[model samples]
Target: MTSNSPKVLVFAGSAREGSLNKQLAQLAAKRIEALGGQATFIDLKDYPCPLFDQDIEAQGMPDNVLKLRAILAEHQAVFIASPEYNGFITPLLKNTLDWLSRPYEDTPGLGLFAGKWAALVAASPGGLGGIRAMPLAQQLLANLSLTVLPQPLSLPGAGSAFDEAGALKDDATGQKLDALCQRLVDSLAKTHG
Candidate 1:
């Protein structure tokens, strides 16, 4: 069963003060809200989790990890803006997912991701638009049982893609971003109903 408004959580992988991925995430959240879904924007900087280490897990999950897990559980869908670091997802995003995927005493395995709906977007100053990272992110999420949208946004030359207001400057690119996000919003509404 679904509520009248499906809560969609949005977040970026980067913690940099002026990250391109953060801009993309904010734009996605606006699109989701415009489509009438409730959008919850989260900053990973505020919910830092330690690097996923087996020794650390044995010691017990950190408070921030637990907090992020609870926040994720509250959302019906998730939108991620990941940055590609050396042709891979940033350590920040990977670590957050790893910690969140761990099973709590009463939670089912893969509870954070299993059957979850996800949409992906990436931005980078480089010309490739962080496209190199999408497949890996998709694979990881798919492995965890997330039904990720097959097509993801890859904003090339992100350095100049946005205007002073943080919105995409290129009309074509902005439309593509909007369309991708709309697809996720519409799919989630359809699935929940």
Candidate 2:
């Protein structure tokens, strides 16, 4: 009922090309691989769905939603890098979680997120580092019975933290991301087996 490879999924919750949150996710992936975990990032751009509707539900769930759930089923843990939209979690991120939680109660691989560990990270040009989104993400994961790590890194001033090639430039922020990602790797290692 488990996998041979240790799966560490990374969710980049922002949709902008200049998304600093995505950079944090990229950094997390590097650290995951460094710690012997397989890192996979689920980009929200690839997971766009309309506002959930009962009418839409009557038509059956969408293929893209199922595919995203399948990706969750493949992983043992998650590292979410979310952007704050209108002082809350991005609708894209929330909607993805919504689709992932289909059947509301019992379901097949949709249960993949249950009991799985998750870590939070955020990046933004604003002073708060897109942190406005963290509480909601954590709560939703908890509602799904996912074990979310408490150490969240809200990466403010993210624009200066990376270079032209997207490499992390700030040693302090890099170290922070390193520590957060290590937690994910350790959590996955402990939980996957």
Candidate 3:
């Protein structure tokens, strides 16, 4: 990709070994690269931080949180595949976001996220496809000053959505993912141009 190509950080809220959200995130990263953008796919399991606490902040940010913030600061956009937990965002994601939203050193609170773009997707085995958590996730991102895309993808029956090759089994579902990645890439062009 060119230096001008959009750099996107792609990750999933769930870090379980066989998480459907993780599969979705991996697919998104590949699609982003195919569309000529750069995708930095990460696993939250690698950047573990404690639940957000003022006491911890007073001591100093965790090494992992600092590393994660640095990674985020370098990207122009983020693509998240969130898994729902009881009609809400996963606690891991919420805690991570909370930590990242804090001010560190000279950077202001939300500095890592403000004015950046974000796209969200979710996958679940149930019929709703984790749709119940989309609005909450969107609102949280917006509150951090990120401009979230309007059309979020929610993949229901995720257990069977992907083929053996890790590609979506449905043509229509694949097309939707392509469209979302295209929109993100196009938005970067518009903003950067």
Candidate 4:
């Protein structure tokens, strides 16, 4: 990657083993790297934070949350592969965002999110490909001051979407993902370069 290449943080909302969203996130991270951008692929399972609660916050911010916030702050863009749970974002993701939105030390509310860019994608076993969750996720990110990209990808029938190597089996679907990653990288170059 070059000095001006966008540094992107890539992660999925779900932590379940063999999760399709996780596979999608991994692919996105690779695509970003292939496009000459720096990608940091993280697993939420490694940075476990408790469910957001005011009582907990009143005491002190969780170390994991603080670590996550620091990681986010270092990236110019983020690529989120979320799994749709009941037509909305997963509780884990929402809770993590809630904690990240809270102020700590000299940082203001939503300080980590402000002026950052985000690209969202989803994969599901059913038809619609977790598309139902995209708008809600976008709104949540927007509320936190993130400029979400308009072009999002939702891969349906995720159970059979990938090959043994974890790459998408369908060429068309893979192309769509490529386009989304390209848009994200190009946007970063335009804004941060």
TM-score of each: 0.95, 0.90, 0.98, 0.97
Best by TM-score: 3
Measured on C-alpha atoms, candidate 2 has an lDDT of 0.78
lDDT of 2 by residue, 13-63 (tens): 777775778877887887878767788876777777777776886787787
Report lDDT (CA) for all predictions: 0.87, 0.78, 0.94, 0.93
Cα displacement (angstroms), candidate 4, residue 135, comes to 0.7
Mind giving the per-residue lDDT tens digits that candidate 1 earns over 133-179?
A: 99999998888788999889998899888888888889988888888
Give the alpha carbon lDDT tens digit for every residue of 30-110 in model 4: 999998889999999999999888899888898999899999999998899999999999998898889989988999999
- Report the C-alpha lDDT of model 3 over 30-89, residue by residue, as the tens digit: 999999898999999999899899998999899999999999999999999999999999
Error at 146, model 1, angstroms: 0.3
Clashes of each: 0, 0, 0, 0
Where model 1 places Cα greater than 4 Å from the true spot, the runs are: 1-3
With candidate 3 superimposed using the best TM-score fit, by how many Å does residue 67's alpha carbon deviate from the native?
0.6
Off by over 4 Å in 4: none
By TM-score, is 2 or 4 better? Answer: 4
Q: Select the stronger candidate by TM-score from 1 and 3.
A: 3
lDDT for residue 29 in candidate 3, whole number 0-100: 98
TM-score of 2: 0.90
Runs in model 2 lying further than 4 Å from the true structure: 1-3, 104-110
